[model samples]
Target chain A: MTQITSAHRKLRIILWSGAITAAVLTLGLAAFRMGDDPSHKVTYTGEADIRSQFSLTNHEGQSVTEGDYAGRWQLVFFGFTHCPDICPTTLAYMGTVLDELGPKAENVAPLFVTVDPTRDTVEILKEYVAAFHPRLIGLTGSEAQVAEAAEAFKVYYERFEEESAPAGYLMAHAGHIYLMRPDGRFEAVFLEGNQPADALAEEITIRIAKEMRS
Target chain B: MIRTVLIAATLFATPAFADVTVTAPWARASILASRPGAVYLAINADPADTLLAVSTPIAKAAMIHSVETGEDGIARMSALATLPLAAGAVVTMAPGDMHIMLTDLTEKLLEGETFPLDLTFETGGEVTIDVPILGIASKGPVEATQ
Candidate 1:
């Protein structure tokens, strides 16, 4: 009986250690995966790593850069004029948000940067941006310049061919609206589909007030 | 006698026994003549049916398109061949989801103008509806805010 009891205790100890080892391995694997996935990284408000540099032309046939709008908060949105649904919807709500901002909107400058530089020329962008809001400015440039701007904002865009589409192609892009501080730093990012106009307006207002206090 | 004939013609044009009902049809006004257009609407079918095709006189090509956001947070637009509707079910095409894409527009879709859209269904046959052109940023029909 003593021998049997000792054997049982040894088996129990081995089973417990095996279970602990498996648990630790699973946790370590998960941690490694989380660290490697870019989507897992949450971009917090005022993250300094995101740069807001860009050298592009305005809707008006003149050259412009980030420094042109230095003293005003920039509402930067990346999209193309040919985008039928998502881009227009975002811009429309953004216009409403601007209206909701009331007089405080004077400090905000909304910029629409085209991801499809090949199709969205300066003339097209001027008319496209005008349909949404008067204060909204459209920006476009050479392919390399647009790429640099998109890279700075961490915006992803790709053009794919669709046989049945009218333009024979379409652009897949990230629908994130980046809010930049007056000092041209990243302030906040808004998902186009996630927030309503009123809620977005409120959030922007609060952020602006916070910046003012600081 | 003329008024009676006009009433009869109107009734014959829109059959009362139509199984499919389309409402709140509206399209965003195009910024330029060359730009494509998008239309949204809600459909209710008494019996199950499949949407086979869509056509509009204002555009050279009209097709049903769906916008899906992948796990990477990229919005991709793809062409859908058909849309299935369940019996007595209401399918709504909105801004970020399913929509009708009008490409190679023959003319610019100006605000306040109405255009005819022909929707062909598998069981319900073809139904033509007038779609109003709203502002580029309009959510839906003025009366129906959805």
Candidate 2:
């Protein structure tokens, strides 16, 4: 009877040790595989690093930077007032989106950055933005300053002329509304046509809630 | 008396002799002293016609442009020299689509003011009509605040 009990105890100890050893080996292999997998590695590419490098002037003729719009989400668009169709239409859409947001809209700031610096002056920008939304801020600067800002945003713009076009000419630019977090990280982009006010409002509301939680 | 007779004939004539009529002509008021603005109108023709050109004394230059939505959904304007209209068809020019590009305004176009736009047709000659100015956000004649 004593020998039988001793054999059973030895078997239990062997099983317990074997189970613990297996668990430890499995964890070790997982850690090793995670290190070998490139997808598991994290890379940091902060989008706002270039936004801070730009300095432009608002419609008030005050020098403004990314810091001026801190503490709130930024919705930025690059366009000019002379743009007869796209600029006004898209800005009006944004106005609708912001209006739909109501009080929560206070958390987002809409910015209109000019691609045509030569023609879009401070006064023109002031009146232009007012035509769309009261909360919209129009920004313009010198040629070089505007170039730097456009480069930072990676927006494409070009001046093209027609056979009998006016001396002032016209500009073709990428039409995109960029959504940025308060920390200046780019969150998403809204296309020109598919965006409805209610849809955009829903997306922004969700993002704001998630951000608050984090 | 002859001019009245001709006018009556044009309006009362059949489809074969009916002339094109321009309606719902409106433009957006400009805030800047010299800024571009767009004018929209609807052209109704009983017979086929072509819009050759448009001119206005309010702006130094006027051109016809068509705004096309690319696959990416961005609207881009391309200049058009002439626009062809089909018989019994109505061509409507509106914002974010086809429009008259009024460039380098001589003076600011204020709200509630009216200006003349001269539209030249290939066979119908030129017609001068008063285009009422509305706020920049006005979408059409009905929404315009006169």
Candidate 3:
């Protein structure tokens, strides 16, 4: 009993240290790409067994709990509807991967959670995200909700105005793609730059297979 | 509109004043059958002459697309009835602004490779440009242009 208690105390101390470190890393403000190294690439931090339980709304306007995502892989993109180009391109690419994977696509859920929640309401998200890939899901919520979620993910975004929209707009945003596993643990992240479809597919396959074995 | 005229005039010019060049030529390739491949090339059309639509063997249906994304944010791409090249006008075809959408690609457009694209204009005559393929990243900062 004494040994067990000592082990329990050690585990509790480790958990507390981890929580404090994570808090310092997450400043509650929009932060740019977190894992960029000297190579200027999206470095893999391995899958984080994230226990963050978030309740948000899907593009379908349905209440999605963490349980709904319990048994599949997920590719989450933080973007907005106003993104005329990149958003659609990434969705189409991911959709193509899913289609090519076919039955295997069942293991993956392509999710689009808007960092710009104020403009990306459920109704608009439904029509906009659907235009790219039918399998894509959009998520949005209140300002505080979005800020909290973004803080958790370490995403950075700001507003900018082009000559076309001199009246202040959205554009300045740190773009990154986050990959997650079924148990809701963070997997890998793909940063800006070209990624081969076959490579991505292969990588996910490996991760899923490893996860299964684990 | 204004940028092209000034740049086109400064390039190679004949005594009669007719010079043409493609400014930004970007080609988009996709494996999705539902979508068409897009290859955009900007031509500096001489105001003294005009530019007529050319032909493309790469696509089953080819036409200069006049595209616009309206207030609704829905992009509408239509066949440009006519592309007027005032003697000193240069066309700027870019992403989210103006571009060519190639439909029903014959084959895959591999990255770092170039393919032959023919453009027949009224004054500049037939100009075949080698369109290079760019790899489209899944998402993020690097995929900005795609």
Q: Of the true interface contacts, what fraction does each candidate have? A: 0.40, 0.20, 0.02
| Candidate 1 C-alpha lDDT tens digits along A1-214 | 0111111111010001121112221110000010112234333576676667999999998999999999888899999988888899888878988988888889899999999998899999988889899999999999999999999988899999998775688999988888999988899887654655666777888888988898
* Candidate with better lDDT, 1 vs 3: 1
Per-residue C-alpha lDDT of model 3 across residues B1-146, encoded as one tens digit per residue: 89898766654343333345454455654433333455655555433445566555766544565545443233444456457766545465544444555554577555666677777666556667666665442222124233
**Candidate order, lDDT descending:** 1, 2, 3
The B-chain TM-score of model 2 reads 0.85
Task: Kindly report, for each predicted structure in the order presented, the TM-score of its chain A compared with the true chain A.
Answer: 0.77, 0.74, 0.72
lDDT of 3 by residue, A36-99 (tens): 2334334466645433245679988897855787898887777765543445455666766666
| Residue B124 of model 1, lDDT score | 65
Best by TM-score: 1
TM-score of each: 0.80, 0.73, 0.52
Q: How many collisions per candidate?
A: 0, 0, 10
What lDDT does candidate 1 reach at residue B136?
A: 73
By TM-score, the candidates rank as 1, 2, 3
Residue-wise C-alpha lDDT for candidate 2, range A126-188, written one tens digit per residue = 888887899999999998998888887777777877554555467777777878888776777
